[model samples]
Target chain A: MIQMFHVTKAYPGDPPVLVDINLDIDKGEFVFLTGPSGAGKSTLLKLMFLAERATRGQVLLAGRNVARLRESGIPFLRRNIGVVFQDFKLLPTRTVAENVGFTLDVLGTPRDEVRDRSLKMLRRVGLEHKADVSPLKLSGGEQQRVSLARALVNDPALLLADEPTGNLDPALTVEIMDLLTDVNARGTTIVVATHDATLIERYQKRTLRLEKGTVVADERGAKAARLMSQTA
Target chain B: MSVASKLAYFGRTAIGSIVRSPFVHVIAVASLSLALVGFGVARIARAQLDALVDALGGEVELTVYLAEDAAPEQVAELEQALTQRTGGEVHRISPAEALGRLATQLGEDGKALTELPQNPLPWSLEVRLPKAARDAEALGELSRRTRALPFVTGVDYGEEALVRLGLIARALEVASLVVFSLVFLTAVIVVSATLQLAIFARREEIEIQKLVGATDRFVRVPFLLEGLLQGLLASGLALGALVGLVRWLESSAAGPLAFARLDGQLAVEWPRLAGELVGIGCALGLSGSFIAVRRFLRV
Candidate 1:
């Protein structure tokens, strides 16, 4: 769960990127943060993940004030959140399974469990057979799936994705979205930032539209909410 | 993973990275080994020089020869004058005793010395200064004062030459320290530069690690391991090179240049010096890795 009140983010020599913003995301909710280029969508997500601090006001993640968090505690907080990027961010030198297991390794998980869970996650992503192959050799769709597997392997409570499908073709875009929807159905909160209007209309998730550092509209897709409840 | 497993993982990844870029690792190792060799050589030279100065500076004595026709009384007078002037223990050597010493020095050719004209050697006085009077300036003054004795024919102490060599040895000691310090700093910089390249090559991997909630320490340990491995390998190479150099010098010590013979002067404290070199090598590696990680890896 995340709550931001009167959040403002500004950079030196530039206008405010996100100003006077307020929003709430409940546990297990799926959110579509839609905005044009440079509309502060990514910046908003950054504040939630503790990548950057708010210029004004407060950020609360799961009832903890982020601004007051000590530097040493940041890593522990991040353990509960997963992030995916447009570029996949997979290490080409590593196999798909290693990529997934990296997060578990950082947590000091047992070796046997890490291997079993990583392989299990790869199977869920329909890439179990490709687990031993280098990420460099996988197709864009497969690579994106590997990235998703890595993010979700730790079973984080919240997932923040920035333009997760910006580089994928339309078919692959839907493939990733369906995977995200499936993850949401299993009770992980998801916030995806994008400018793809068609995808928004098709998925029909709760949408928060931003323009010039301000939230212009917030539309809860009622039909999508009903579908999610039925799946639960 | 367990702590043991984590350490194993870090070690494997570090070795893998090094293997992936063998050329870069080789170059780094070579540069570091050369730098260490320079430092080792300077350190050994300074130590040897210090030992030599200490050995030669001890047991400093002067030998003054009497005129050929000087009377026994004159010799006695000169000996008494030397004792009073230097406050040193004086031993008189009669001309006959000097001739006997020459014959003994001739060894198997003592007969040839006996065949010479009768008692050609002169009476001499050996002045042995106490430890307190061995200062260069004091010895020089004493030598000058003894040469002015009317019955004295010649004075020999080699004090001036020893003083000059001591000055050169002192200068070399300072030079060696400066050279060692400079090379050590330069080696650290070289290591830092090399590691920067390695870090840049893995920037994407690092970014993904950070994204997956890897702590800064988790991300840094691999690079630190890599630096440590490089340093260890370089130090091994340097030790080998130093041994070979010492052996080669020892083999050639029998050549015409007598001064080139170390005469066991190069028998350094091997275990201590090796430990120091290894310690320094590790320090250089760790320092460079830390700087690189701090500068480039924001996490």
Candidate 2:
């Protein structure tokens, strides 16, 4: 679970990326952060990932004040949260299996276990056949799945994805959503930031919508939106 | 990762990366070899000159000639007077022997010189001093004192050879110093640039490692160790080159030293040359590693 109280992040030579934003995510809850472009979606994900600091206010992850924690403690926080980037920042030099096992490598997991676990996850993502191939040579959709497999390999308590399906075809997008749903059903907290209106409508998860660094709409399923999603 | 795990990880990466870069290794090894060559040449030249100085050690003997018809008592008086004045031994150079030695030296240039009439050479006293006696001023003063002795026609202290050899010694020292300084400067630039480029290539890796919970020292150790290993390899290569150079010098003794007039065995100081090569090789290795590591670690 993560909590951000009045978290505002400002960068040099630019306006504040996130305004006094207050958000709380309870344990085991699947939440969607739906917003337009430049609405602080990536900035919000970065704050949670400890890739950048909030200029003001507190961010607590798993009951620990991450905003106030030392830089040395950030790795411990990151280890608990698996993150997927929009571009699926996988090392091109590594094979699919090696990519998935990198998280375990960071944890100092034993060699045989890292191989077995990574290979198992690759099988789940239907990339078992591509296990020996470099991620650079994989298609966009295949690469995205590899990233998702890597993130979920450790079965982190919290999973965060920044536009995971942004570049995928509709079919691949649905496949990834189903994968995320399965991970969530197995008790991983999932928070996805995306602007795909139809997908969000279909999924019908609780949404936090942001516009211009402020939360413009924080709501449950609205009347017309709910009916349109059920009919679809 | 635990310390051991991280160390093993870094060690594998470092070795693997270096082995992959043959061009860089070649350049580094060449740089090391070149620096050692300068050191080797300087060392050998210095040893040779030092040996020459030691072997021929200017406690020189000047043969002071007597008038050819001088009486035995006069020669005795002169010898006594010369010894007292110079505070050293003065032995008589028999007229027959002095003539014979001169004939041998001048005779090499001509058989005609040996056939000259009645060997008109003078009996002389070979005045010798302890090894402590050197320096132009002191030897000149001793020469003047001997000239004042009875029947001492002149004091031949071999001043010309002493002056010329002194100049040669000074010139060798200057040449060696110039070579040493140039090579040392080259090494500094080469090592610093290598380390700087290494730091650049691995900038993101270093940042990622730091984020993944590496301490500053742990982050630094592998690169530092890489530089150290490079230095050691360079030292070995340089040492081999230097040893080959020395061996070649001894074999070809055909180089400039072979042409030099000094007794080859007496003038070539093998022990001193060996010591110098060892010192220079170790110094370059240690200093290059230290400088490379310190420069990169600062940031």
Candidate 3:
């Protein structure tokens, strides 16, 4: 679950990047945060994950008031939220499996369990055969999937993605979206930030469109439920 | 992860970082080792000098010569004063005894009839000072006091030799201080600079780790470990080199420099010296990496 109450974010000497935004999403929902470039979508996701703080108002992610969270509590809070970047922020020096297991490793998980869970996640992402290979050796799509496996390896309750498929071909984009849909079916809430209008129309999900720094439209796609269920 | 697993990860990461950037690591290690070797050599030299000073100091005795025409009572009074001042034995050498000592020193040329119309050697008191009173300053003070006595003609205690030895000791102390300070500073700079480059190379890795919920401590431990390993390796190399150097000196030159030996061996405390060097190396490594991590790894 995610909630934002009139959240405003701004940088010094610049106009607000996000202004007076208020929204709510329940558990297990897959939402598309659609907007053009520079519409503050990434900033919103960052605020949800505590990567950036709101200049004003409050953000509640997974029942915790992120605005009031202590600095030392940030990591534990982050453990409950998974985030994927447009660039697929995978370490080139690490094997694909190692990259996926990194989350659990930070949690101080046992090596055996980390290996087992990461390998299982790699299988889920259809990258099991590439587990031992360096992420640098993978294609763009494969790397993105590796990144996805890493994000979801710990089974975080909330997954925030910023242009998750931005670097992928149309076919690869569908592949990543299908994986996301399956994750949502297993009870993880998902928020995806993107500027791809075609995805907005094709995915048929609850779409919130942004312009400048404000949300201009909130459209709950009529066929979203049927499409997501069919895909799952 | 268990504590053991965490430590293993940190160790592996540290080793990997070092191997990945061998040039900078090697440079850092070599510089630190050379600095430590300089320190160790200085310590050994100082120890040898201290032993030599102690040996010479123990034998130092003051010879107080009486006035040529002083009476017997004057001689006895001077003897009592010298004994009280030095708090040790004061043996009186009569004119006859002094002459005999000179004759024996002449070594078979003694038939020259004591070398003069009359026995030339004066009555003297050999003042044996306590161990604490053998330093140059104390001996000089006692000599000045003795020379002011009415019956005393001269007080000689090899003052020049003692003064020179004192100067050498002081100079060695200052030199050790300067060497240690410079070496420590150089090692810290080398390590921190090397670690800074490693940090830059791993910036992406750091960013991802933080993004995925790694703590600041988690990000920092590996760099600190890397610095610690560098320091340890440098110290090990320094110790090895110092041992080899001492062995070489002993085998090839100990016979020529017999006085440098202490109880048939060098006076170096190998275990304590090794422990100190290792401790210093660990400190240098920890501090250097701490600085680098605090500045560069802003997570």
Supply the TM-score of chain A against the true chain A for every candidate structure.
0.90, 0.94, 0.92
Q: Write the per-residue lDDT of candidate 1 for residues B1-299, one digit (tens) a residue.
A: 56788899899889988887788778777877887787788777777766666555555678898887778887777788777776789998888887888788888888687778777777788888654555668777777877887777888877776577558666877887788788778877777787677677778777667766778898899988988888888888988898888777667763522363446437567787788778877777777787877765565
Question: Considering every candidate listed, which one attains the maximal lDDT?
Answer: 3
Candidate 1, lDDT over the whole model: 0.81
Candidate 1, which CAPRI tier?
Answer: medium
DockQ of 3: 0.55
Off by over 4 Å in 2: A220-232, B1-8, B18-188, B202-229, B240-253, B259-299
The best candidate in terms of DockQ: 3
Write one digit per residue (lDDT tens) for candidate 3, span A17-127.
999999999999889886777889888888888879999988988788987888778888888888887788888777889899989988888888999999999898788
Worst 10 residues of 1 chain A by lDDT: A223-232
TM-score quality measure for candidate 3: 0.81
- Candidate 2 to native Cα RMSD, angstroms: 7.2
The first chain of model 1 has a TM-score of: 0.90
lDDT of 2 by residue, A104-133 (tens): 767777768888999999888889999989
In order of appearance, the predictions have TM-scores of: 0.80, 0.67, 0.81
Judged by DockQ cut-offs, the docking class of candidate 2 is incorrect
Q: For model 2, report DockQ.
A: 0.17
> Residue-wise lDDT of candidate 3 within B179-200, one digit each (tens)?
7787667766766776677567
Q: Count the backbone clashes (under 3 Å) in each candidate.
A: 2, 0, 2
Best by TM-score: 3
